[model samples]
Target chain A: MDAASAAIVAKPASVDGLLDLASRDMAGVDALIRDRMQSEVPVIPALAEHLIGGSAKRLRPLLTIAAARLAGAKDDACLRLAASVEFIHTATLLHDDVVDSSELRRGKVAAHLIWGAPASVLVGDFLFARSFELMVEAGSMQALEILARASRVIAEGEVMQLTRSHDLNLPQDLYLEIIGAKTAELFAAAAEAGAVSAGATPEQQKNLRRFGKNLGLAFQLVDDALDYSGEAGTLGKNAGDDFREGKATLPLLLAIARTGPSEKAFWDRAVARREQEEGDFEKARRLIAETGAETATLELAARYADDAKAALAAFSSSNSWRPAMEELADFAVQRKM
Target chain B: MDAASAAIVAKPASVDGLLDLASRDMAGVDALIRDRMQSEVPVIPALAEHLIGGSAKRLRPLLTIAAARLAGAKDDACLRLAASVEFIHTATLLHDDVVDSSELRRGKVAAHLIWGAPASVLVGDFLFARSFELMVEAGSMQALEILARASRVIAEGEVMQLTRSHDLNLPQDLYLEIIGAKTAELFAAAAEAGAVSAGATPEQQKNLRRFGKNLGLAFQLVDDALDYSGEAGTLGKNAGDDFREGKATLPLLLAIARTGPSEKAFWDRAVARREQEEGDFEKARRLIAETGAETATLELAARYADDAKAALAAFSSSNSWRPAMEELADFAVQRKM
Candidate 1:
């Protein structure tokens, strides 16, 4: 990490503030998640619980709760919307693991590996459908519209990534667009939907959505960087998984650009042909560090983090939720996981 | 086929009456489907069109339009809902083909085969989300609830079938439950939602739902029977697919029970172990035929068809749609496909 990034990290930025603030609402959301996921089909709940139970952060739903509370929510309808957001997130993760043939997720064996891809796929559908059911019960057409569009956009992003993410010459803007759609869009929708549930003004909804989008971008940028720099134990997924799969994530792409011709043969061998060998990941990581690619990625993430905090400036400083949310932006970039 | 079943088949029941009645509405539905299925992602539209363009009979949406018109709909809202129903059905077919790993759908190579399973799965999600967006456009939370619940039930049924469809000793009621959820719930919801769109009375909505449910049951029963007795060319799918997959559809189950000890070794090897030789499907077909299992299945289908027609008695005979829908019920069981 760069000196500035390292210094910020040394201070131990944390989501504890946001978590504490949203704890009670999140408890309700968790209960709703558990209650709705149950089915007489047995495997539906079993497979959903296998992944959802492993999820420690529940970050997206927390975003919903925090945004709602920040917008002065008076009722518990946001609780249902929060649970709906988590279901959408969980459904995407389930389908993503199946699509990627992923081995691990959230520090546990992937649900597809346990329940089989067919079950995982079907359960994902069930959760997606259930999310809509919850949204309907929440009785906000606006929130439902936001989430439905987000779900479609996320699927499009996944398809785009599947077909384009492996290209060596893929443009950086395209990659950003893919992540913005796939990852940041959900974050934006979660926050916006929560704000809508609380009857926030359009201006407030726009600002909260901006906050979430930037926060999500920062989160994904840091996650991509961590794939090259962090450990599997803390990451909850194998650190070198993206590298082994030859995914053209930001760090690797940046490193290839910075190193120029010096790493041409290495990139070709490791990424193009995917003829990876022992220590290849270590070599790639070393090159990323040596070329300052990891630092650059972290710097970009910090920029987004700053943008995320700035978006919350419209809220009153006296509201504790405001600072808690700003701290969440920093935590997005600073967390090792 | 039994004498009565053969006589019914000789009469050549057709969907032409319903097709003529809903021809204009169906054209609107077809156009809406084309418009909504398009995406900026190239492969999405291509893959969706590959399956959708090959669909000669858009039956579910037809039910929606027919039901709405029968219930005195004057607005075009039901057209959008009809398109939404088709999207839901197409999405399920895409996922179902992937889960079953079938090579044919609607007489064309399955979308998963052409675009790969990941694309198929994501596109299925895209269409599903798009279905909800369309429902939102239709401006009816009631319709959205019905479709959303139907979607969840369908996924649960898919998982249930994935886990239980292969059991040699599967019960008749359990088998009916699986198909009912997987295939018939959408039909019932489609009709009910259409009736809702027209502000139908509760009794009218109930009758339409019954019409749809019974018709869907007959359709699936005939489809199951066709897997054993019909020609692949006429069926638009491999005739022995269920047998090959060791799926205990009613025909195979009934044949196993009625054949008793005589075919014990055959069922044990062919179905229980899925150890089929070159002519095993042919042998299974002959056994199913000789034991009158196909006739019994068709007889049950006929009963459902009769019930479906009876449900429409509440509608005025002067209204052309009532007869068209009744004919549709017969078409469901009597069509070769």
Candidate 2:
């Protein structure tokens, strides 16, 4: 067995420990979220609740709470920042679903589908503004700056992906950059903001941010792999959605590279022109399995999970959050959904 | 003649003084907007420039600059705030165009029409985030708070209008509330943020906010009136847009009330059902003019303009910006477009 494989087997894959530890903090964040999402405009709250209430884990805000408590935060400032982080995440998801014409989110009908795209867009704006208001109340300009910059970077990443997602020739580094900006940047910011709110040392802030960034990469890589490996019932979102959308995720890209000349015509027809027939997704999945692309993708995810765990070296092992967060990193890669 | 009519005739309706007085400062604002709008992603800048570069008046940002200067601001902080105000306005316009499926904005094709709705939505998100980044750089939490609240209020107003705008029986008070939240709140926030940035006294801030609120009401009333009374060639946007969309603007509602039983069937078919034939817009305009609805709307706008001017009485008459701002109020009601 490879060192990476051995490490993956040795690590426990569970978020239950962190969830237990941060239960009170997460509840406070949840309360703040519900309170702030309300508006006199009936559609705003209805539409926001449709998506927000469906989220099971809310891992991004969990990162904030866990990072804050890990850094020995004593005040409730991190609670607001945590809620603000979730709001920012929710706002982006609303915009993203509209941009992608996504049909389902968090195992339910997407907000845009239920309320119409216009309402979804406007409600997203409302949540985004509400997030800044929460940040302002938190009274941490440093956290505000981090989240604001993350917001801009996320938008930029979305635009870049919009222009580049369909191109089969897109480089691996650029793809990493895209996901780094769109997904991992927010995770990094969320943890950093929490640390900043807690008045953590600069080194602690940087390390927590590093942990979040790597964990987010692992989470997204697993997400991409699960689009092929996961079943629709367990995945919340439909499996093969990326394939149907012709999104150039790493699993498909690696499969294409590994299959090489034999699949050239197939990829050109299926992906480049976005024409598909019955059983095409099945065939792609089969090809990916034959090429070991799914395994390769999971391996990459596990490496990132390992890096995420390593980032906790600065924190004392005596602290329970340290080991639980390492388990969270493993869970990010191992979870099926 | 009544005192109101005499006052209307006595006032000089021109923005030329304000434009000239703030030309140098506005130039700085213009430069800041241009520099900030640029992005590594090409489409963002391209789409942003489409709407922003076409705005000849930029009334909101102009209000911010005028308010700061009138409050005796000697620093460049107001310039960043002014630029931020414009970004907020521009972001809303981009999203608004998508929500309304608008074809034209600021005298050119709407950005969404050229780039597609997804691009427009994402780019608007970009600009909105960029607005906050600019606010953070300005280093005034008070200004940030004011703008953040304005943004949330604006989104709520839009959602309310989306649900209520098409109703033929929408009351005038409700209509005023809709427009006040949708339009006036930002104007009020812009001026107040400027005042706050300049370290103005609480009274100065309150008066400037009042000035902006009244000016915004005057501006919107004239706009609603112009839909029936102005020409497309002069208006930039097509004339009768409100009537075409069956929007229950003040003039339309007033005309509906004044014409009463005589024109009941025509309104029911044209506005209530939104089922119009070729000549419906022209006929609605004719009814509005014949009923003196357009004139009543303008009279109300003139009153608001007067209130806007009165709000500036606390500022010294010696400051050139004071008279310039008052002229801007007059011009809001007086302009043909």
Candidate 3:
């Protein structure tokens, strides 16, 4: 092993120590990403550099690297695998913006807004193709199978969302299914790939995958809850963006189910018209609180977070991944955005 | 083999001769496609059935079936492979219409115009994912590799087209490169997969793939040439559409190289403005014909057709596939639209 790999193998004694480890390991993958993203098309490099260079928590890749380190495998291949997850995530964002016709992402104009829809769509396709090529280089059919299945699940979830749009009767189970396929699948795959690459035993890989899956579900539940409850400034956008779009997210679903006849008309109009007047946002917010949907949503998020923490019980007390996994569960529900 | 496999093997021989083989084999695949395309989303089934039910000639899938038959391999696998090609081709068309913001395709409003852009984009992704699932069931990694590579090439060609848009300096070589990747790669893969499924020798499979590749190239060149010369009513769109879009196709590239100073200025303005007045279109058409660019483009298409025909020489003269291959070559140039 090289100097970087040797240092990465050493145990991090604290949260700051883990962050330092993550930062150093991610630097190599980040550089590799920067190198491959260059294109003669002026718009490509500009959009890629901006979106990729922009501040991202890097949680997904960090989970991948941390999981591999916990499994006692530290190698350059793990770094490449970690980078592959980031590329896949970034590619999905580009396509998602185009499909949603989204204007703002991460508080900035979307790639489609600046580069036009065609360029953004095609560049997203390029990133997806490049990601497959990168995974192919990893020489693991198992990893390819995991990533491919995750991609298909993500696409299907997006389709399900499209199909469910504005339908106030969307069952909570269906909503959970959509979130699991779209968000948790990728998280699970990332952690599973890390463990598999590190040659973890089958049972350990399953536990790690379950941990990531629960964590992802919790993360998305919190995201949906925050759409109704988060501060607009802190979230970098207005609260109720999903409600404005007529998305039948968790809070709205729960609220509609719990509302009385008097509030049903208001909910119907809000969902059908997908528009809120000056005071309508406040009324809707009050209704959600009164119906106890806010509490239910947060409670559900907490339940998933607890499940995530419990999955770590499969690992021994001496394993360094335990604390990081616990912190990730906290990060899922506790983040401001 | 089962009864269906036996029927597939025996039916092609009863289809009169090699030339009629394509149409006969296409009927079964077309019926299978229509049956399989049923969906819970009303818009999905409506749009997919309408598009796939149109006059596509089923050339790609026919190439696959013909190549397999030529290789002396007969099974149910060919039907699955043929349907897989059509599914992928249809999916790409759905996505391409959105990317191009195209109003009309096959003489009708595109799916996006009918159901809106988000629906079209998401449904397109659904079909793409579905194609993978279908291919996976075929259970051949070699087939998977071919289809995956073709998809990557198609996306790369699309990116190249997006990058080269409105750039008058695009060279003929680059134009060929783009078309080869965008158009020919899928056709080649379709044929190659047929041979692969049928367990053909490597050399025979390569020859069939080459044949499909050249034929696809020739077909695209002819289509591009007709965009400048064919009647608007016959071709289902206005002549000079590529020129209006500032697309650097073969005829325009040749015209620019051969025209005089005054004609060159006209070319520059017409291409730069993209949408030209009647007078501009007339002058541009006159200059292109006067410089023999039309004839030169025809010659190029014919040469590719010949190349396609020659690729079939590897098969014995007595083989049924040889004449069907020749007919495909001829049909590549003979089409009015």
Candidate 4:
């Protein structure tokens, strides 16, 4: 069997194992998130509650907490950093829903849809500001620098996505660059900041960041593949959202990379022109599956998952936290969303 | 003459003189703003250029730079703080234009109007992150805390304004509180951060912040009045915009405060229902003039200006920069916009 079949047959890692491993730290993070989300202005808390009170996992904050624990942190500064990292992630999601004109987020109505765009935008700013305040309270300049730089890179990636939205193919290198900045940068930073909070060695910090970056890439790839995988509950939002919005995702990009002028024209007319007829999404999904883009994307994701696990190999085998982190990477590839 | 009459006749201080006083430091800030605005993502810089390349006064940075010099700053850190202060101001302006659905900003078309709201918002986020990076680079925890808290307050104030937009009779205290957070907090933070960068005594920091807070109040009052004052160049955007948007301004609030059955009906129709006729702005302006509300507003602004000036009196009667700061406060009230 090929590597793709090997990946497809592989048993997924247990996410519950990692979560249980970091259960205490996760509880602290959740408490911090709840406390910091409150504001004197009633609407701030109202909007925050609406956005955060959902079934969606606080994965980014979990990573921060887990990374800190894995690196042997002593104090509660990682709790603050974990909360801050999640705030940034949540803030970005709020703004992104507005930008994408998304109708649903985390299996619920988008905050921007309920509140006006203006209020949503301001509340996102509030959360971003609060995140920085947490970093300041943490009193780590290194953590502050990493997260702040990640935020700038995230915004840059968003703009690049917007600008490149004009072109359909979007090029492989640019797609990687965009996803690296948009998704992986924050993941990398969250892990690095956690390591920094623990006062980890430079090499340890670099290893943790590498683990996170590869894990993030795998997570995004799996998510992108899931859009066309014809699986319900795999996407937080409606399936074919990427198709309807003409957003270039990995599966679609891989499908576009295949040879066929007719196939190219079909995508150009459907996605580039946004002139989708009835059954177009069905056709697009079928075409993607026919080309085995979903399988290919998932295979690539599994590769990254392996890379993430390898990055953590330098950590002592005796350190039980390292195994959980490796399992977390596998879970990133295996998760439906 | 009545007290209002005396205020109308008062000779305010020179703004150009204050700008001149801080010209050398202002150059450093301008250079920093230009350099920091650049991003690897082309659209980031492109959107920033459209927003920042205009008729912006950047008064916030001027106060920061001037206050630092007055407080005896020894290094170029104040220049970084000044630039960061201005970036925060610029970021809010970008988001404000989108929130207000503004057609113009800084005497040019709004960035949202040009780049679309999504791009405008993301770029605003980018600039805001860049501002935090600057604060972190300044390496003053005090400065970071001040600016971060101010940014959060600014967002809260914006949400408060949105919540209160339904009520024409938004109470005076709430109005003060809203504007204090939305406008004055940043000004206060700017001053405080400058003093922090300078490593000034706590007393000096308090005085500078007091000066900035009052000056911001005075500045906002004048701007609120200018919407009805019927001037062209005074406003960066179109005149009567506040009236059209039905946004609560000091002139409108003062006009509503006057007790008359017919007055209440008129405002209810114009602001609450937003059912103004073609000549309604003319009538609103005439009514404001007739009630001495604009004059009253200006008088109140002038009083804040006096308080702002008084805050600096303890610094030194002989500090060359002190008189310039006093002039800047006076200019905040006397300026057309």
Model 2 DockQ (Cα-based): 0.86
- Which digits, one per residue and each the tens of the lDDT, describe model 3 over residues B1-337? 5322343355421223444765666777777777656654466667787677776667788888888888887675776778878877887777777887776666667778887777776666556555655565566667767876787678778778877856777888989998998799999999898899889899988998998898889888888888877887777555766776788888888888787575666667778666466787667677678888877777777778788878888888788778767766766765667
lDDT of 2: 0.89
Q: What is the DockQ of each candidate?
A: 0.88, 0.86, 0.32, 0.90
Q: Which residue pairs clash within candidate 4?
A: none
Worst 10 residues of 3 chain A by lDDT: A4-13
Name the regions of candidate 3 deviating beyond 4 angstroms: A1-32, A35-42, A62-82, A192-209, A231-240, A256-271, A279-292, B1-46, B67-82, B140-143, B192-209, B229-244, B256-259, B263-270, B278-291
What CAPRI class is candidate 2? high
RMSD of 2: 1.8
Instruction: Show model 2 residue runs off by greater than 4 Å.
Output: A1-12, B1-12
Q: What does candidate 2's lDDT look like per residue over A1-337, in tens digits? A: 7534565578646789999999998889999999999998899989888888855578999999889988999998999999999999999999999998888788998888888999999999999999999999999999999999999999999998888888888888887888888899999999999899999999999999999999888888889999999988888888888888888988888999899999999988888788998989999999988899998888888888889888889899999999999889878877889
* lDDT score of residue A46 within candidate 1: 86
Please state the error at residue B31 of candidate 1 in Å: 1.0
lDDT of all predictions, in order shown?
A: 0.91, 0.89, 0.75, 0.86
| Tens digits of lDDT, candidate 2, B244-316 | 7788899999999999999999999998888999999989999999999998998898888889899999889
Per-residue accuracy of model 4 over A261-286 as CA lDDT, tens digit each? 86887888899999889999998888
The interface RMSD for candidate 1 is 0.5
lDDT of 3 at B314: 82
Per-residue error for A159 in candidate 1, Å, reads 0.2
> Which candidate, 2 or 4, has the higher lDDT?
2
Q: For candidate 4, lDDT tens digit of each residue in B81-198?
A: 8999989999999999889898877788888888899999999999999999998888898899999999999999989988897588788889889889999999898988898888
* B82 Cα displacement, candidate 3 (Å): 4.4
lDDT of 4: 0.86
DockQ score, prediction 3: 0.32
Clashing pairs in 2: none
